[model samples]
Target: MVSLTPVDIEGFTFLAISVELPKTTLLVVTSERGYIMCGALDVGLLNERLKDRKILAGRAVGVKTIDELLEAPLESVTHEALDAGITPGMLGKDALLLML
Candidate 1:
């Protein structure tokens, strides 16, 4: 199951989605500014690593998860996010701009 809500932040309105799957849940907030995501962050390391540095390129954030998520280390990021000065240890919420 997935639920979507409208979010207002930094004068921009974006869509936040919560996805429930058999093994995990995913949380995502997306806008023209960027995309923030976590929980079951990634599936495979090698494939993800390459794609992370390429397509995602600082526009995405990934984090590991167990049960509910609070604060966790970033597992991967896109180049655009890196350009935004984001890195592996930044808090998920902090990495996301205009988060509510």
Candidate 2:
């Protein structure tokens, strides 16, 4: 299991997702709008998956923009996570560092 923390980005909200891999843990930073800015890649499958999906694929995967987040409900994030095959249970302790 991994943990994540919520962060604030220039007044926008962000969250960190910590995933357990075969050899190491990955920490990914995602905006409230669902944009994954950066993080660590420790899982081979995850690395491959990310590589297969072009960077910024989150936009097409259902992650919204700042404007979208302003109007979207919190459930939208959960829905996006589900669509991405990421479980809320899997994102418990990662800290969401704010980017201001």
Candidate 3:
């Protein structure tokens, strides 16, 4: 089953999804400021796969599951994300801001 909810974090509105099997929640955040998806088992793989896609969904973040993502002292961000000043140890909440 999948559950979706509108969530507000740090003044950002995000669409949150919960996947039953993986027990992970995917958040879709988009605005004039930026766009990105947060949640997954391997953030490194996530960025790699999307590296060439160049879709409107400009960013993909692997928080390594729901908890790890919400508490992102560790993350595998895309190169574009890197250019935005988001680092590995930066919290997911903070990264969300620069992802644009």
Candidate 2's C-alpha runs over 4 A off are 37-100
What TM-score would candidate 1 get against the native? 0.55
- Lowest summed lDDT across 10 adjacent residues in model 1 is found at 61-70
Between candidates 1 and 3, which one is better according to TM-score?
3
- Candidate 3's clash total is 0
lDDT of candidates 1 onward, in order: 0.53, 0.37, 0.53
Give per-residue CA lDDT, model 3, range 1-100, as digits (tens): 7666665677777655555666555554444454445644344554678667433232235554444455555345556566677666676556666643
> Considering only N, C-alpha and C atoms within 3 Å, which residue pairs clash in candidate 1?
57-78, 57-79, 57-80, 58-78, 58-79, 58-80, 58-81
Note the clash tally of each candidate: 7, 9, 0
Candidate 3 structure lDDT: 0.53
Clashes of 2: 9
Better structure of 2 and 3 per lDDT: 3
Worst lDDT 10-window in candidate 3: 53-62
Question: In model 3, which residue pairs have backbone atoms overlapping below 3 Å?
Answer: none
- lDDT score, candidate 3, position 51: 62
For each candidate, what TM-score against the reference?
0.55, 0.33, 0.59
